[model samples]
Target: MSLPNAVDYSIIICTYNPDRRLLERCLNAVSLLDTAGLVMEVILVDNNSSSALYTLDYVQFFLNAVPHSKLIVAREQGLSYARIAGIEASVGKYILFFDDDNEPDPEYVQVQKRLHAHYPHVAAWGPGNVNVDFIEGVDDKLAAYATEAFQDRHEVQIGYSNQRTWQGCYPFGTGLCIKREYFESYALLAAKGKFSLSDRKGNQLSSGGDVQMVLYCISTGAAAGVAPELKLTHIIPGKRTKIDYLKKLTYGTSVCYSTCLLEIFPDHLATIKSQMISERKFAFKVLKKYLMLFFDPRPKKALKLAAYIGAVAGDYIALNKPVPSGVLWVLKRLKAI
Candidate 1:
């Protein structure tokens, strides 16, 4: 595989007070032995983490092992803040975003080169993220990750199994990679204590910030594609793997998605809403799958599937609702929101 001769490729991760054990696995993956040739740096933005969970041993090891990585502490509240800080600090020509509770595949770094080589005009690429449902034993490095617990990948063109469509106007964050210039283009501006990306605060809670970025990218007519080769294992904690979490995730996804779609086109929302309502066939299909899982006899798998389908239902519900309540509430709540 021919890697890009470009100067920078920053792997930016935004993390909260993370599950230490899971984070350890991800840090290990990020600092793998074969990462030497990739022209990149790992920028872990600490989201106000007091101790900086990526420990000194982990930091020193990766700095020594991975070739390029720098740990900088950023005191910010949300994932968006951490990500933005990482972007501003990076010198990489391309930036790759990672969540804390993920273990990237060993072939991950190489995929960046492979994709860029194929489409020089393409601004972004999302990898195939295999979701790990649950891991047992607190400190066990060899925890189990169920491949069956995956989510929708929007790009199937590059062999990723995103459920949305072969070609997407937006992509997922787990495997999301973009040119550094693209990230820098949308810096948060402030005036008398206001910001340019200011409208995003309410949208972040509903989980559309990443999707919103992808939409912005695609709408601008920049080339975007999805590749399955760049991989990451998204770990699902015990709590997140429950029906209760599913309900919350579902509602949040719906609210967030609605907020994103409406933002991209203020006037076309009604048309989009109508079209979404017309796609009840797909929504029903999603619902039926969840109902069937209840009788499927596997507690773990059933619960996992339930959460996913519930999220879809929530999306449809938000679309069909006469008024978007949470959207308004969120706007009113966050001061800088």
Candidate 2:
């Protein structure tokens, strides 16, 4: 039951130094949202941007145009910190998180609210159809692997019971929605130092806070789901399509995978030790995988190899084991160690 006169939803957009055009597009889409009968508030979190975002003309316009909208600055420099700031300031029953580059369909909030009603057992959910719109065209090499950087979940239909079957079933943070109660619990855990994933500090692509949130929800006997009706466009800048950028993203994601595993499972170390392979064998595997990069040499293949090596390094750090010399050499060459 909702409290009397309480806001129904809090739309939180967390961003650092964002592109002006993209921010304008995002806010414009939000301003046009179909919010007829629902009580909603938009909270724009400036995550330590270099400039004063609240003073920007467009930002001021947005704040004045939308009822109950305001801009809050987060002194911290990470995405997770900005999100925490948003959570702390929100009073809505449900909280929605959107990136500055995300543009939702006009009916996104309504659709999300309807779906939540349909799946009351779910604690969190997001859009199933997340499409990418590139600001500029890419070369064939970069274009082939460009989509991998974004998400498209049109074919996925998941419920709480099977949320853990695959990572795809987990909701991406692009347009994630969570019950305020569950999010408050997560915030408490974070405050107590129990949850420590600070995702994407400034330009660094490190992630997994979204995954951690979903895992925590599931651990609390709740469910998560995705709905095709909840749609959004992830605007991608041309610079991010470069091979070097993709490689960095791959490495960051790989490390995040290992970090999240260790965070959620207390027995993770025991499990890894029990099934550990000899250092020599692991070194040989790394060498073999690296050699494949020389043969295929495609951007996609290179990224795949980077992800594998990153995962290995992440495991080494997480387990406090010495990285094999060969793996160490590879990581140094990739500038990821």
Candidate 3:
């Protein structure tokens, strides 16, 4: 796993049974990136894809096409584990964590390079636009997110961002850039059995790895930020537009939110209790706003409220039991945990 000594940026794309068309678009965009004199490397981690990726030439095409790029197989079935492998294998000063379906803006690298040079802590993520090209009958909720959630184009320091709002400064493992040291520290912590959360385990919606990493950075004097210039277009397929998937995603989001809260405030019962009380108050306020639906309900409005309830439940559950992490090294070798 030895790498060249002078690599500037390391891009890690973690994928599991991805759509070939979407992946191709992502790689196409990667091919066109203007490095601007900075040396870069791209590490593609295949998270136990059952598809005939290598035999079908999808993996081989990139090996020959993208410079300094190689495919690594992460037998583990979780996104967090795949990312850990990438962080361990990468050899660059800075690293970008990208999903397989993400298409970065051309100036993404250039802007990120500039920001990391100026900002010392070097932990951050950029917003992503929704690419609805392949989607049919695009869901209103999904479309609204692209324009509304990531609409802001300014740079916001992490702690100061709207933590209460869903569209906050938190990074979601897409187009997220951080110094290599931060990722190394995160991997070390996980290896030491300090923490664990499922940020998409197989077909499940559970997610918290990115959030936990950011929390770690904040705890250790690193401040993450929202760098608008490092934007990407997240390819939204029809599958993710389904109601069932959305519900699951909403639940996962809530669970992760609560899980992170528990991890951060592991100190005192009073502090955790107060935060939970505040959370319930916020949930009650949301329910109150949509209470009229009991008499005259709109499907969309009802669905939205249901998702909120799911999150509240997740918060409660997390208080009692949090995700555990161990045997990661053994899993890396055995491909099962």
Candidate 4:
């Protein structure tokens, strides 16, 4: 049922105002992939970057070096929109999404092909071994958290499951691989105005699209997993290593948590509602418990408090309810309102 010239994989790199050095390194790594006998295409989607990045010398050189490669300018300025553009343009059986800063190993494509053949039931999968290559050194206090943040599946095994949540089972956005058909379905939903999460637009770190995708996969009876053989290096710039950046990232994820979950798993409405209420209550308790700590000189305690505040805000937004007086008082006391 396959066309004679059908591509096996489509590698989609979504970027917006990317760092030139990081992009060059990413392109070089992609160019070195062992795709000798494999039919593949590289789709670099520029998500409303300020300049025409495809016209750059290094990018032009890369486009010439790789066969079946092209650049697409997504007028929409969001990772979700860029990825949807790539999905619509792809003709491969499997679609691989790599962030602009991700560098796949030489054997990445081959490993993915093998995994697809071996685990036909897995609709989405990601790299279990995601090494971080930080351009500059990080603070000693933030080093451990930064490492944990960047790496995926540090000690998890490779297997497929229908878990609804993305704790240890689902993949993130760094090097996410999925069946083209599944993504086509996702795109159709987006087209219908059902999918509205614009992940990481501009510099605002509102993220949930990847989690939505994983949950959608599970909802559709498809298994998702992580494979250690699939490897990639997530390049981290010095700016993202700062405590403030991490705090913002945490808050962003927390704020989008409830909305993403409810959107994908509507059938579990009652259960999710109950969970949200419990979480909101717990968040208030956490804020109260850390009221004094928020004033500490160290920013670490404030970061922890911000995550709980974000969760409470997310729940209130999702449920269409106003913040309770007590919670508002606590938030005000912590100067987080």
The residue pairs in collision within model 4 are: none
Residue-by-residue lDDT tens digits, candidate 4, 1-337:
2234789999999989989878989999999999877999999999988888876899899898888888988998888999999988879999999898999999999999888888888888888888888888778888777787676446356867897766675788878989988899988998898876878898887888988887788889989888888889888999998876787787777778777877787665676566566545665686566766746746667667767777867777667677666656655555443
lDDT of each: 0.57, 0.81, 0.66, 0.81
Candidate 3 lDDT score relative to the true structure: 0.66
TM-score of each: 0.68, 0.92, 0.80, 0.90
Rank ordering of all candidates by TM-score, starting from the highest: 2, 4, 3, 1
Evaluate model 1: give its TM-score: 0.68
In terms of TM-score, the best-performing candidate is 2
How do the residues 227-261 of candidate 3 rate in per-residue lDDT, one tens digit apiece?
55566777767776665555456556555666665
- Model 2 C-alpha lDDT per residue in residues 118-237, reported as the tens digit of each score: 888888888888888888867687775777667744745544443442355668788999999888988888879876678899999888788788777777777887877888988988
How do the residues 1-337 of candidate 1 rate in per-residue lDDT, one tens digit apiece?
Answer: 2234565578887766667676777788877725556576778777777566557576567656655567776675666667788888877888888787778777877878777887777777776545453665221322221232235332334642222222443346776888776677644422232222222231243365676666556555666666666666777676654444443444444445544545544555665555553344554554465456558745445444434433443445445553233322322321112
* Reference-based lDDT, residue 84, model 2: 88
> Candidate 1 vs candidate 4: which has greater lDDT?
4
> Which pairs clash (backbone N, Cα, C closer than 3 Å) in model 3?
none
lDDT for 116 in candidate 1 is 82
Poorly placed runs, candidate 4 (over 4 Å): 1-4, 277-290, 322-337
